[model samples]
Target: MTILGSHFVDFDTARILVADDDPILREFAAVHLATPTLEVEVAEDGVFALERLQQGGIDIALIDLDMPRMDGFELIERIRWDDQLKHLPIVVVTGREDMVAVDKAFAMGATSFVVKPLNWRLLSHQLAYVLRNAQAESSVRSRLHDLQRVSDLKDRVLRLSRQKLTGPLNDILDSAQTIEHLSTIPEISASLRRIAEASVALTRVHADMGEAERLTPAP
Candidate 1:
């Protein structure tokens, strides 16, 4: 395998899509971009490339600016507009001396780019970096989502504790203290009324304890 990283994706089966009008450069990319672990697929023009992308299962796309059916800029625009494919990595491969096209491609959401008459080594390095970095970023987003879910669950439990458990338990403790105080009263100590009050207080305490137990949250 040419590259294996801690990004949590199976890099060995990663598929690449290369789109260009020129068969020569398309072949060049198809040959040079493939590692032992990488697979490369080619599209003759922008439209075909987009069709393939929409079908899914591709990891990254290398697009050429000048093409017959939908040029690279439109391809990039369409991909960004699409919710499913918006985050797909797109590398612009163009020979045009016009810096405007390069700038526009970036504005249009091209992830990376290499000029035509590509330095093979530089192109290889750049593509590798893009793939690895994309995997890392995706991994980070997934972790953040998981953390947010845990935080939300914790907030919910805390609310339940305060609203359902704390208030009722505090009232139960207060009732117990009131019963103790009533028992110490000199005149009522041996009176029938004091015994009745003690009975009522104990009954209420039992009910409150049952309610509190019912509201106790499971782990």
Candidate 2:
């Protein structure tokens, strides 16, 4: 989540927004983004998209150039001008292939463009690429905002696990010391059993810590 690396993967669970006047087209795009890995949201038109953007929570917008009420270009312009929405990544998904339209879209702050009849594979690839770039950009901004939260999450896991380990580890150490002191007892069988149990307990704590470190993000 921190850095949306440069790679484009097909089965990645990404949140995508689609805005199209035609329900069929919108549905088509939405369905394509809905692989087992993706989460898709739809907006019927530019107006609806603006509302959704205001509400927030969208990772990327897949917009149609031709629409009713407010067109995609106008929507892009408004999005770029709005301070709150300025950084939102936009990808034009439309039938219009006119150079003028493409130029206008870029001018209005679109990050990528895809001419439509809807190629699912290509669209998926493009979306993944756009999302990755968006993530990189977001990561930069997140560093300024609350990246410390990621580190906090890692620290919290370590703290809780350490707390849980403390009691068990102390018990293991005490048992080991007791076993060492009781070497004279009946063949020393009880001492050996205690020492073996303590060793197992200590091994588990360290093993769990190693697994936790591999799973948790570092800052």
Candidate 3:
């Protein structure tokens, strides 16, 4: 339930998928991961696994590196490109111990890696850790997105307010300029010219404010 000393997965309420080309291995894993704790589904290959995933309701996935129709690497790529499933936790279970393959799996967004002929006890603990971390990460990302959206909305409001203020200032400056040019009184014209200058300054201030608002980051 608790992972890395933080957060809980509530595994009893979770659903997991096990995909392998070997029926015996698949069945073994299904039995191993299944307890009163977690629900498990088995797929014979990557193709079937991907199909079942798209049908929805999968929280975590265990994939075998070798399979017919489609391989684990290709399956990871497809899952990464899917908007709804991109964040799903993928754990690669393979006998291959090559450093290159391990790095490649991480690069492809695998949440974890495990060698085949699995030690069921360690795997159960690892799976619990992965699920807890995944849930915590998702919660953080959702909060960040909400914060960004609110920030963007605030920026737009400031920009629109500045824009509304800028137009009136511009009109006032133009009217003051016209009145100043037509009048013969030097003192009145000087005051009008000062008023026009203040209007221009206000316009510049709002123009800068609008630009700053536009530069705010989006969600």
Please report, in order, the local distance difference test score of every candidate based on alpha carbons.
Answer: 0.79, 0.79, 0.85
Q: Better model by TM-score, 2 or 3?
A: 3
Give, for candidate 3, the lowest lDDT window spanning 10 residues.
Answer: 1-10
TM-score of 1: 0.68
Best by TM-score: 3
Off by over 4 Å in 3: 2-12, 96-99, 172-208, 214-219
Q: Would you estimate the TM-scores of all the predictions? A: 0.68, 0.59, 0.76
| Model 3 residue 20 lDDT score | 91
lDDT of 2 at 153: 71
What CA root-mean-square deviation does each model show from the true structure? 8.7, 12.1, 4.6
Q: Model 2 — which ten-residue stretch has the worst lDDT?
A: 1-10
- Cα deviation at 1, candidate 3, in Å, is 3.6
lDDT of 2 by residue, 98-210 (tens): 76888888987999998867777678777888888888898888896676776787677777877787777767767766776777775585666667677777768767886
Q: Alpha carbon lDDT of residue 3, candidate 2?
A: 32
Given candidate 1, what's the lDDT at residue 193? 50
Q: Which TM-score value belongs to model 3? A: 0.76
In candidate 1, position 6 carries an lDDT of 31
Better of 2 and 3 by lDDT: 3
- Per-residue lDDT tens digits for candidate 1, residues 1-219, read 143563222354588999999999889987877766678899999899999999998888999999997999999999999988988889898775868889999999999888878876567667777988888888997899998888668767655654675555556556655665667676654464545556566656656666655676554
Checking candidate 2 for backbone clashes, the offending pairs are: 13-37
